[model samples]
Target: MTHIDDEPGTVSEPPRGGRGRRTALIAVAVVVVAAVAVVGALGLGGGGDEGPGAPPRAGSLVPVTRATLTERTEVDGQLGYGAEIPLPVKATGTVTWLPEAGTRAKRGDTLLRVDDRPVVLLYGSLPMYRDLGLTARAPGGAGDAPSGGGTGTGDGGTAAGGGTGAGAAGAAEGAAAPGARTADGGTGKAAAANPSASPAPTGAGTTAATALKGMDVLQFETNLAALGYTGFTVDEEFTARTADAVKRWQKSLGVPETGTVGIGDVIYSAGKVRIGRPGVRLGQAVGENALTYTGTARKVVVNASAAGASWAVRGTAVRVRLPDGTSVKGEVASVGRQATAPEGGSGEDGAGEGAATLPVTVTIRDQKSVGRLESGPVTVEYVGREVKDVLTVPVAALVALAEGGHGLETADGGFVAVKTGLFADGRVEVSGSAVRAGLKVRIPE
Candidate 1:
């Protein structure tokens, strides 16, 4: 994936090593971009080269507009629970039972039956790989997510709130922070992000009364609080009050009050999740890749270019189209951190290498408008780049300069040199001492 350089306003020259006529290639690419911009601004029927017409008749001349020029675009999207959540198995056992598809499982609920033992679900974005038993190592890690493993929601709903579990000392693990808002409308900053940042596993299976130190103890402490067992400072140090709280939580679950959390006792996740189809059948041998499922949340997801990502900030309004031809308002809820390489086909027919893309998620504002359609293809329109109060002209109006760059040919016999900035809809952002909103320019037929 290519990183956008933070370099300020540095001009980038085109690739110099290619064998083709670079100037012609660049000119062709520029024409295409200008055509798109003009088509968007003028609301033309479609885009293609319109052959040049005779010298500008009064009717053929178009005046530049002084209002805002916004690039509103409609892109295809998938309407479903944003992305699929994988339930990485930390336990090894034969599958005894699997939940029916479309079942909804909350935290602490039974997600599956392995060897007749229930695989309980825990809410948090982090995955579980080790048992939650008493140990000397802490549990926080520098990772992110709360896709609610072992579950899938088709409605495209997200795990609500901004939250994070802090790892005890350097012993934190299962850190999943997608930087989402917490339920209290607060950011989930108590997060344990460094998965490998935890203390080394040592002194396993200490007595319940032992004053333990590590992230596992810390997570065990936090899970107890989330489960409503309070009265202790949630930390890596296992004090007497912490033990009392754990024992009470165990008792509530109808298990022995051991005052110790087993690896299988509790689960972690970003929050509650809707489960999808199970990955295994009954009696299947459990391997490294055991549990997997889709999600049930209803969100419109788009794979947008870096240009589109520029407008992916939270709270941007979007128009979504369902399968029924119904249109509903949506909002940009989240944007991914890093850009990812285009997946698959890199050949002539595929998303070529070198260029990267950003993933954007939009949530439907009027939920009732969507009705029962949970998963399917949809379209969304985003309000893109806006150039305000500037002189603009149809891309077809541009006349290549013999001296280099581009210029605007006046209706009569003169040409004006202009500096261009943004390109949107079919209009190019142009400014010059002489250019105004009402100036006339020639257009190709």
Candidate 2:
């Protein structure tokens, strides 16, 4: 259960979370085991359905008072690379050369060289599937990149890069775009062996190949545009410009300048990734598990309970407390709706049992906060909303009336109808004409 701290008004009382509060009357302290069924009732005020002031119950009397209320929840989280992602193999070919483990590549650099072709990296969330490039006979005047955005085609020369294109959040906009370099720093783009000549992929296909649909095609266009290839609009379908772009890309890459893209020609990823150990040695058959890469920057993930998920909302402000007692600022990057096992396999509610939680990803805005810390356990504190200077009474003081309303027992034993409001520190906000400072009300223990 999460604990709430109180801030009293005028009346002196120890704040539940430290920073006590003051109230005009007796320091009001209330603790309710059950959550208030209606929170909006606190905002509502009008004539009560019940008749004049009356005290019907012969119970203990508690005075109405004012105070500030806040709720705080603390949860455990781990600090480290946001998440580990596996770079899947998109092209079918023997691994010619793989970057040594720990070798980090920039966003647009080559992470893998398959059959001497470059598999470039970009920063984006969408995954590449189909082969990307232009067709020999495109519908629109023999040229253009995808419609969304892309670098247009160049004259069968060098595949240009750094072209401007619309960017998607979380998507890798690699600096090189596509077909810029191979593992050996060679352009797989062999300058058209003969000026006005086309190059080839030793034993593979070229841009003259047909383009496949899906996110894969779209990303390729985005990659090409980012690489400075413009002239065609970035879109999903292959166009003459895309083919021209492909030929130029191939030409610049030192490969056969075919105006088509093949599956084995290029690979797309989110961004340049530090190479992990190769799954297969050079010249080995490619497998499903290609390689894994982690985010260059560090981040933290919190497995929060469903009830506590509101604090972990996307973009919510967060304060991370590191093991060294240092504090850092961050924001919720993403929240997972899927439920997974809690810390203890059960939950924070009790002994390890049937407990599940929501996975929340938090990104550290300031890299300096992490300093030299690599990874470790950390604490996260969420500061929820605060209700201030409101008429408050002990939760026990509220009684559900039979006439479709809630009320408080007056000093004369008559019931004064009232509405409930923000609940905090076992105290609740109550509003009604019958409510006032020092007005005593009956409460059941």
Candidate 3:
């Protein structure tokens, strides 16, 4: 056996056992060195070559695009019907009326029958009486006689009793007597005693004495006449004639010709109607002085105020972000004419008072788009000016520093300050000597 020493200067061989132990120790040292190298690489990998400190890596990015921008204003309002009318009970009778509620009536169609007996007596008596009295006082009591009765005078020139002195006296007495017999053997006593005896006059037809008036009524009447029911004549004043007209108008308009206009009844020109404020029901009592209808044009209006108002204007296009994450394009229809006081107070949070604003009407440029939007809280975005074909970067790519500026991280772990322009759609336009398209940037992972 040859004896070997492990020392370098000695050409000696070690025992097999020692050789195996040395091999095992070498393997352990190699593993320890590799682990140390890996830990060092992880800690120092983010250091940029440009400077001792740099922005962290960015995790995401977005692209820039060129598009047309439209300015817009935003407002809130409700959907409403164009027209409405209220029908009231004009005659004061139980609703046993004609032209059932909600039924269509035509011109001259019967609407409702009131206990017109009262009104007839109230209006008809005097005229009938006057005419009857005139007939009773006529000469020879001829008018007083029934229409078919013959005259009392004979063909002889001398009156049957006029030649006798007693006859003349008797005739004079007869005419003056409060109660006396007539030549026809019929009693003229009643007519002679009461010269003014006559039956009271009465009204005819199923019309109301009181009807609605004002522009609303006229508009309704005009519309009714146009519908081919011409029985009604428009007289600005609400009268029996007007009531009759309304009934006719209602029938033509496809509503119950109840002689009374009620809320929700379509009156006036077609498509130019109104919605009642309080609403109208069948059999509901209405009167000339009552508020029976509202025009379609009347509606609640809303406007923006504070910074929002200043940022928006009429005719400017805006996007309304609904709760569902969908968006609708709308134009600023108007600004308030007057600034209202803040809802609570003038504190920092208080809405300021009397902020004058102007009203703007936003015509629905696209009805389909507007239909998706509901009347409620929504986010509005007004498009500003646009920049085209410029160098840009994702907003996330830029790191905000303690200093007043921002810096971008380079692929090799270097940082550079960048000049930024308009920011939009998650990207910002940037200008810098070292910045270029397609350059890799580091952001926080």
Best by lDDT: 2
Tens digit per residue, CA lDDT, model 2, 303-408: 8876557777789888888999888998999999787765446654433764568889888989897899978999887766567888888665766554445666
Which of the predicted structures, 2 or 3, would earn the higher TM-score when compared with the native?
2
lDDT of 1 by residue, 1-445 (tens): 3423222321222367533453553454345535543544464412212225332342267777675566666778889876556676555678887777667677667777666666667665445545443444232222212222211112222233222432121222212233445464433222222243442332222222236677766766676687788999988887778778877876766666777665554456666666665667789976544655554457898877654467778999988878888889999998887666665634232257634666789988666788988889998877755668877776556655545556665555245567766555545677776677787765633
Q: What's the TM-score of every candidate structure?
A: 0.50, 0.50, 0.39
> Which scores greater on TM-score, model 1 or model 3?
1
Task: Tell me how far the alpha carbon of residue 130 in candidate 1 is from the true structure, in angstroms, after superposition.
Answer: 4.9
How many clashes in each structure?
68, 77, 47
> Candidate 1: misplaced stretches above 4 Å?
1-42, 45-67, 125-209, 285-288, 294-296, 303-317, 329-369, 389-445
Give one digit per residue, the lDDT tens place, for model 3 in 309-364.
Answer: 55456676665555566665657665666555445455233344534333333334
Candidate 2, lDDT over the whole model = 0.60
Model 2 bad stretches (over 4 Å): 1-71, 100-107, 123-127, 132-219, 231-241, 270-278, 306-310, 342-355, 389-445
For the record, the alpha-carbon RMSD of candidate 1 to the native fold, in angstroms, is 24.5
